[model samples]
Target: MDYQNSLAFAQEQDRQDPLHHFRERFYFPQVNKQDAIYFCGNSLGLQPKSAQMYIDNEMYKWANLAVEGHFKGEEPWVTYHELLAGGAARVVGAKESEVVIMNQLTVNLHLMLVSFYRPQGKRFKIMVEGGAFPSDQYALETQTKFHGYNPDEAIIEIFPREGEHTLRTEDILQSIQEHGEELALVMMGGINYYTGQVFDMEAITKAGHEVGALVGFDLAHAAGNVLLRLHDWDVDFAVWCTYKYLNSGPGGTSGVFVHERFGKDPSVLRFAGWWGHNAKERFLMEKGFKPMEGAPGWQVSNGQILPMAVHRASLELFDQAGMENLRQKSERLTGYLEYLIDAVPVGKDVIEMITPRDPQARGCQLSLLVKRNARQLFDKLMESGIIVDYREPNVIRVAPTPLYNSYEEVYRFSEILHECLEGC
Candidate 1:
């Protein structure tokens, strides 16, 4: 699809967009009493308009039903998380039974690691991407230490080749094979947070398995942003936060996927809680820990109703829009963003796109390595009500989300950025 860096072209695309109505469903942040052009969904998505109503419904249930809300409410609190499983499963490409809405992302990662990261004898090393999200780094570091292995030795980081900004799939697969004998688990972000490079999870999963290692992903960026097939890819496990592309509230409840093979395996280690016990016998207060049949069995506590409510509101929108439709718009939206950036004289000279050029290798995010006045330029955007984010050093991350972002907004951002650079 050829893209033009003009407002008319952008407006034309917006007019033709099937998902254009989705923009009105979200409440954008106010900057100077105007709706800001939000390009920060990679960080936190705009709140859905129905989120308040969803939360209010749960609040009403709690007020009227009290403890009885557990079972007596219109949609019982006891099974609230269950209602989310199907939608969350669709978002991550997993069967309903293979997915569960549960604890925070890092916590879920730790839980999955406990079961899948078991290292025996010489096969204790964990392979991960270098410069992973800090939480993942810390989780792997602490988990290695907890298992009485020195992190420096037990953790192998796969770094991009010299001067490269993203990991090549070939390099990743080769690394997996090189450490095959000692690798116990291969854990990576489905999409790299900084570069916005979508990893080839299917190939990575196959490579890990070929090496006799379990594979998992932290899909925090990939969940609602890119197409995923955790089950078909044979990903052993995965975890994601819903707040970013999923448009759940801040610190929202996360979703987890445990492959059907591990879903009900009695031998798999997990931090068990009452909620994860067999629902039929749960009220009996039985002494034994009889796990639920699938992914819910990994739940360590009862659900958080309010967060789950907000999540449900957004998931409903996703259900209506469909991931495939969203992806189609996303490619064009992000492609237009890339095109506009390149067409802008200042953008071409001062901004370097670190994200993969191929649509299939990235989601909505494009990480710009700003050559000059990065902070000032980011502040300029903020002052102009163009919502985007700046990372440390020189990177500015822009995400033109399909659910709410507009192509015209992307064009406007390029104009603003060009003006900012000219002023600099």
Candidate 2:
């Protein structure tokens, strides 16, 4: 695909895009009262227009139906979260039984660690990336500490070689093998939050299994952005948030993926909760915890109805559009963003792209390692109504999402970036 840096070319592409109609379904934020060129979906997705309606419907059930709402209404509050399981499974490429719409990402991570991160005598070390999101780093650290092990000694951090911004697959796989018998678990983000590099989950899962280790991932950045085959990859478990690419709402419900091997086997250990008990005997309120058949068995509490309502609305759009179709558009949209950025005058002197150039190695994000006047340039971009976000120190994370972002918006963003660069 030869991309031209022109509004006309962008408009032509948008016109031919099969998913173009989806752009109209979302409500973009106002930049000086105009619809801003929103490129922050990687951080927070634009709200779908139908979100309010979904919330209203639930609120009505809560108001009128009261105690009976759990069993009454078109979508019963008791089983509401179940509505999202099928769509959620499709987003991450897993079986329906293997997926659970449950607690927040970190909470679910803790639940999974309780069940899977059993550090035995000789094999007690966990492998993770050097600079994972603070939440994940904290979760793993505390989990290790709770098990009475020193984090520094019990954790192995895999880092990029000098002068490299992204990780090498060979290096990661070799690191797992080098730890061999010492490695108890392999936990990492499916995509690096800062670098926007998508890890080879399948390869990593296989390598970890070869070394006698259970593997899991925080798909906070990968869930709706990249193509995942968690079940086929034979991944042990995974957790992700619905607020980002899934476009559910701020602090939205999160999802978990548990392979059937662990999901069905009641012998596997987990922190028991009432909601995780079998639905048939739920009202019985018995002493013994009889866990459900699969991933639902991990549920700690009942559904967050309002948040899950928003999630249901967003997921319907995902199911209608499909992940394969979304990924198809995402590659080209993100590529166009990179192509334009690369064509910026002075290139590496002004900014260095840290994200992997290969489309398959990334999703919709392009992390710009700004070199000169980083804050000034970022401020200029914001003042010019381009809604991109800036990280601490130097990087500015820009994302052009496929479901709602347009090629014309991408072209216009490049033009504004040129203007901001001039000020810098």
Candidate 3:
């Protein structure tokens, strides 16, 4: 597709977009008394229009049914999280039984690590990406310490070579091979947050397994943004927050994926709770902890109705739009953003794009390394009602989400950015 930098071209593209109607489903933030051009879905997605209705329905249930809402209300709070398993499975490419909606991301990561990150004798090292999300870094550090190993010795962080901004596939594969013998687990983010680079999870999984190591991923950035096949890729476990691309509310409930092999295994070590016990036998309150059959068995508590309600509302939209359709639009939308940015006279010299040029290596996000007046530029865009985010130092991250963001919005942003740069 030849992308033109004109507003007419952007409008034409929006006219042809099959998923254009999805933009109406969300409520955008106000900017200058009009809908802002929201390019921050990589941070937090806009609220769905139906989210309030969904929450209200649950509130009604709680008001009317009280404790009986667990069994009697519409959808039943006792097994409310179950409502999400099929949709969550489709997003992550897992079996229904292999997926569960549960605690927030880092908590789920810790729970998965409890079962999968077993280090025995000499094979005690954990391999991870160098600049992992701080939560993951802390989780790995503490987990290593809990097992009586020094974090400095037990954790191996693979960094990008020299001046490169992202990890090369070959470099990652080679590192896995080099540490094969001592590696107890291979854990990484499915996509790097700062760079917006999608990792090759299938390749990573194969490499980890070939070396007799378990593999898992924190899919916070990747889950709704990219195509994933956690089950087919033989990923041992994975966790993701729904607020970003999934468009759930802030601090939304997260989803987890466990391969069928472990999902069916009752003997796996987990910090169990009553909600995870077999549903049929749960009422008896018997002593033995006979776990539920699959990923639901990992649940440490009962569902939080309000958050799950908001999540279900968004998942319904995803089901209607389909991930494949969303991905197609995403590629074109992000590509258009790139094209428009490049057409600016000062774009090449004033700002550097750190994300990979290849679409397969990234999602909707474009991380710009702004060389001059970065904060001022970001503030100018903000004041103009263009909603993008600025990271520390000098990076501005813009995400043109396929579901709600428009091509015209991308074009408008480029024009605004160009004007700001010229004045600076």
Ten-residue region with minimum lDDT total, candidate 1? 340-349
Q: What is the model-wide C-alpha lDDT for candidate 2?
A: 0.93
RMSD of each: 0.8, 0.8, 0.8
List runs of model 1 lying over 4 Å from the truth: none
Which residue pairs does candidate 2 place in steric collision?
A: none
Give each model a TM-score.
Answer: 0.99, 0.99, 0.99
Once model 1 is optimally superposed onto the true structure by TM-score, how far is the C-alpha of residue 396 displaced, in angstroms? 0.3
**lDDT to native, each model:** 0.92, 0.93, 0.92
Instruction: Give me candidate 2's TM-score against the actual structure.
Output: 0.99
1-424 per-residue lDDT for model 3 (tens digits) = 8999799999999999989999999999998999899999999999999999999998998899889999995589998998999999999999999999988999999999999989999899999999998999999999999999999999999999999999998999899999999999999999998889999999999999999999999999988888888889999999999999999999999999989899799999999999999999988988999899899999989988899999999999989999999999999999999988888997778899999999999999999999988999899889989898998889999999998888999999999988888877
Residue by residue across 1-424, what tens digits does model 2's lDDT show? 8999888999999999999999999999888889999999888988999999999998898899888999997788778878888999999989999998987989999999999899999899999999999999999999999999999999999999999999999999999999989999999999999999999999999999999999999999999999999999999999999999999998899999999998889989999888889999998988999899889999989989999989999999999999999999999999999988877785547888999999999999999999978999898889889999998899999999999999999999988888888778
lDDT, residue 310, candidate 1: 94
lDDT tens readout by residue for model 1, 1-424: 9888778998998899989999999998899999899999999998999999999998898888899999894699889998999999999999999999988999999988888899999999999999899999999999999999999999999999999999999999999999999999999999999999999999999999999999999999999998888899999999999999999989999999999998868668887889989989988997988889889999889998999999999999999999999999999889988887888886677889999999999999999999988999889889999988988889999999999888899999989988888887
Error of 1 at 111 (Å): 0.9
Error of 1 at 1 (Å): 1.1
